[model samples]
Target: MGVHGTVAAGFEGVREEFSAFLTDEEHAPGAQLVVHQGGERVVDLWSEGVGGESLLGVFSSTKGAAYLVTALLVQDGFLDLDRTVASYWPDFAAEGKGGVTLRELLAHRAGVIGLDAGFTAEELADDRAIAARLAGQRPFWQPGRFFGYHAFVIGALVGEVVFRATGRTLQECYEERIRAPYGLDLWLGLPQSQEPRFLSTLPMLPTPEQAAEIEAAAASPYSLGGIAFNEHAPGNGELYDFPNSRAVRAGGQASAGGLGSARGLAGMYAAAAFGLNGRAPLLKPDTAAEFARIHSEGTDLVGGMPKAFGLGFQSYGAHFPVLGAGAFGHSGASGSLALADPRQGFAYAYTRRRYAFPGGAAPENTRLLGAVVRALT
Candidate 1:
């Protein structure tokens, strides 16, 4: 299987790393990678089982898009970071959450990770439904005392705030202000016309040893990790199946329901940090820095792992040493990762059709990103 697409002259090493990655995999994990240096797309590549135009379920990498929209609204003064969330959506004030500020909510500190009564499949597919139920739920921890990864519901939570303030859904704002203007291939609410390009996400094919490790590390459905992912729900399907549903892609639940190609993901971030075409960057340096600054760092209460966050985006510098200090982005459960490194003057996106073993950002990103950084230097 040959790698497809072009790399600028000096970036051939990235293509070599990508091909090596495909060769090392036991199964062909249809993958796409894109990188932009300043305003120019320096790398655009895809491997077997997928095309350069193919769209895959990007899972939580979708969060980066949502966070970018929120950051823009804040930069425009339509939203306030320090103001209590209850000020925008009064219902969120119920159950001792009145004092939870927008900043705290974005940092995963409000503690209402999920409902004690888990969400139905339909509710999980709709951001409005998820927000409505969570509005009255009690926090899992004292609000502002601790932070947890609101894995499945943060997008809906932030979307609710966007709706209350602007009388528009975050998806709507994204399409109108970001996607359409930039002509980006990424879609919050994927339309019928673009359906043909989407490929269903495949489950992870782990080796026997890897399977045993996953089984051993599995937590109870009622555990914090389980609840955060809505695994406690009676009829809940696997996480990878979330974006496989047409309804999920159509609704664009905001948290993990995004569908896009690597080009779309990379382009969006590039437009945000370095501008695209002839336009000015979407975020001012001050606004971008504020949202990208580390707001939370340490063991996450829900996942019980060392995690870092800046507003809603994952602060990637700690996880990827090659990235600059304020680098920000989000990774999907299917091993997709996308972000813009303002300090490094580049935006990178990698998407996979099959879930990577050990999940999160995918181990291959470390080597692949290293190759990209070296080429840039």
Candidate 2:
């Protein structure tokens, strides 16, 4: 297999950069890259071992879609961000979290990161099950005072609100409003018919040095970081295997069970920010700005590292020097990244069927993204 796809006239360098990155990889990354300059796709490329249309597990990048759904509802006045989560789902207040606003919850401030006892794989795959269990779980930190990743359950919590408010599953709303309408390849709840294009996500192939670094920073299975990722759960599978399960794909565990290609992702962000296919943008300018504004910054309590978060998206300006102040997106365990840079008038996405060396947005994005941005200018 070799690099295959198209690059618009000005983005030839992006194709060269993608080829160069795959050539240097010891393992075939099976990667795809897509860039949209406003609503017009400027680059579309894929490397060996994966087709341009293959839908691979996007891990946390799924949150970008989930957040977009939430933003739309808020924009339409179907949901209120300032209202307490308890107002929508009363059970959410059982653990003295009655006051946690929907805004705080989206920013990962509700503090019900994971179940105190942990979830079985089946429960973890079902957002309703996850939400029910978390309703009474005590917050690891005071609900509004501290923030953590809520790596596996934020979607369930937020989705519960959508369900209670609108009487529809978050997945249903997404499919009806975004995926089907746009003919996107991304699936929140992948149907049986679309399973042929699905590809299981590959685990990270870490270097000896990277493995040592992981071991050195290892936390207890019951620690906040571990629980947040469901590492403490009995019989919980590896993080990389979450989307490999048919149950997970069917249920569309909103936090991380999304399956998509680079085209789907880039198209999504482009639709939100720039009106894809000549249609109106999914989100109005005010909604996009509100979601992209920084809501939380400083060290992440669960990951124990510096991070920045907006409504439900990763704020890039503080940490990613290449992006402007309002750029927002999410990175996944498979080294996939997707986002819209409103100020720069572009949307970009990269996906991998093979996990990257260290994980969390392959480092090559620096060069690849730099190439795309430069081409735009």
Most accurate candidate by TM-score: 1
- lDDT, each prediction: 0.93, 0.90
Q: Which candidate is the best by lDDT?
A: 1
TM-score of each: 0.99, 0.98
Q: Which 10-residue window of candidate 1 scores lowest in summed lDDT?
A: 21-30
Clashing pairs in 1: none
Q: Write the per-residue lDDT of candidate 2 for residues 249-336, one digit (tens) a residue.
A: 9998899999999999999999999998879999999999999998988889999998899999998766678888899899998889
Model 1, span 69-145: residue lDDT tens: 99999999999999999999999999999999999999999998898979999999999999999999999999988
Worst 10 residues of 2 by lDDT: 20-29
Candidate 1 regions exceeding 4 Å error are: 24-27
Q: After best superposition, candidate 1 residue 96: deviation in angstroms?
A: 0.4
